[model samples]
Target: MRQSQNGGKRVLIVGGAGYLGSILSRKLLSNGFKVKVLDVLMYGREPIEEMLAHDAFELVEGDMRNISTLVKAIERVDQVVNLAAIVGDPACTLKPADTIETNFLANRALAEACKYNQINRFVYASTCSVYGMMEGDEKLTEESSLNPVSLYARSKVQAEEGILSLEDENFSPTILRMSTLYGYSPRMRFDLVVNTMTKNAVIDKKIFVHGGGKQWRPLLNVEDAAEAYMRVLQEPLKNVKGQTFNVGSEEQNYQILDIAKAVKESVPNAKLIVEGEEKDLRNYFVSFSKIEKTLEFKAVKQLKDSIFRIKKAIEDNRFSNINDPKYYNVEIG
Candidate 1:
């Protein structure tokens, strides 16, 4: 594996209309990469439509399941970032079959296409939810055993394994296990915990805490998550290729109550409500040491800053129709 000369490389970003994909596409374009975004655009392309005007940007409206579309999208691309997926636990639960097909099987198809086309780098967006539950004080690393709890996590694990298996002398596959992403996006989602809490606080002056809000988890700002990908794209291939790196910071780990406090700190008028006897079984704190040591990467955004941004966005009506089903992970239609 050889280091890629960052500038002038062509990148194909699958699911470019989605949250992380849209941000990553913009970051790559700003860094001078020729960008082609392949998305089904299920929600809309408004997030990236502006980039289409750029000479370096191209859009392919298609599905990953379609091999013909994947082939065409992969053409003349130096690297591929697979971000196309059903996304989130609720979303995957609502569309279990589609989740399996898109998150797992489609990835298999993408791997085959990349291998056949001899693509330079393949970066897969996986999640830390693969570490479902932790025993004692153990902090999970890339080497930690996976105990995936949801269909979404399971599918990501499958995709990660399959993509790595396809890696050889010609193909370099990098898996990024990202922490729970928050913060504003061009395609903003109120479905995420922080955003949802902040929205409820701003509109109704109350935020609900489910199951006493005790479970622990790591969080990362969307911009920081996108930055991790850029680092992989710019770094030496031998350092990142065929390796799985956890992308996040230990400083962001917090209990559910801690997040609620953070939201209240941003919105002092907000009240707290505890409801439901059911606890979300997924709980774990992850270590980001591997990526930090290897890539010299560290998350720059803090939780307070994310809280402030979401609060301001909500207060200023930046996210109008926050109740829209399209912005939520649950499929209303």
Candidate 2:
């Protein structure tokens, strides 16, 4: 039987200092679980320093590549949310070897550690990018044949298969293939499409639409993405255990130009520029009904709202160091 919410159950967040991991750590703490953050602290702890004051929160500064560190982190934790990785296509492209070692091999090490430690509930944060270069408007589901175009997506697909294949009577690993996330974060990243356009509008007073902006992509606010992890933590084991759920909202799909226009509506003075002879290969609308039906989870933030938040952040000088390498992936660094 699955363990219920008790006072002593520990939750270990593998990359708790990164964008999504930072948010999930706080949410888990609020829900009465002891939170242990195991991250390299690549960007620093300013994002989650406040959480350290909580009696139930612990931080382990280490890399996921170190199997000894991973084994130590999982020691007594009831659940493990694996968010450690060299994220994004450009980042993976820059360091292909490191990406594979960290994203795939490290995850395999973590799964083995989890199995050895008897920590069953393993939640993997994957990407919708696994359904690379889709044709037409068909919404890609969990069963959809994966067609990964980028090295990063391929790494995630390999890791997902490796982790899920480890499922047994004792260990129940759950995979969440998250859509393109946008919105504010303590460790904010402006490289994402929505956030980048919003920042461009607020700072440069113009929005650039690449390749005429016709590429379709689904987006989810970062907060909603964090909430999906919480829902998985609370749901019945049978419903979520050993399952892969695509995290997103059906209504959130929009073309790149549409998102830019939404930003223009929010920032009226923002100009629109379309350029670039090259077109991006990734374009697809994802189906999120699987998670919605099983866990009753739905994204709460809209694209309009995300634009407003980002615009306001820029207006208030919250991101004065906009070009810092902290928010950029390996490629941009």
Candidate 1: clashing residue pairs, number: 0
| lDDT at position 17, candidate 1 | 80
TM-score of each: 0.96, 0.96
lDDT (C-alpha, whole model) for all candidates: 0.88, 0.88
- What TM-score does structure 1 among the candidates reach? 0.96
List residue ranges in candidate 2 displaced over 4 A.
1-8, 331-333
Clash number for candidate 2: 0
- Tens digits of per-residue lDDT for model 1, 216-281: 889999999999898898888888878999989999988888899999998899898878875698
Q: For model 1, give the 10-residue run with minimal summed lDDT.
A: 324-333
- The residue-by-residue lDDT of candidate 2 on 1-333, one tens digit each, is 223564666889999888888888888888788999999988889999999899999998998798778777887789899988888987888899999999999998898789877788889999999999987667898998898989999999999999988999889999999899899999898889899899889888999998878888889999999999988987777888889999999999888889999999999998999888547888888898988888889898988988898888888989768888887665353
- Lowest summed lDDT window (length 10), candidate 2: 1-10
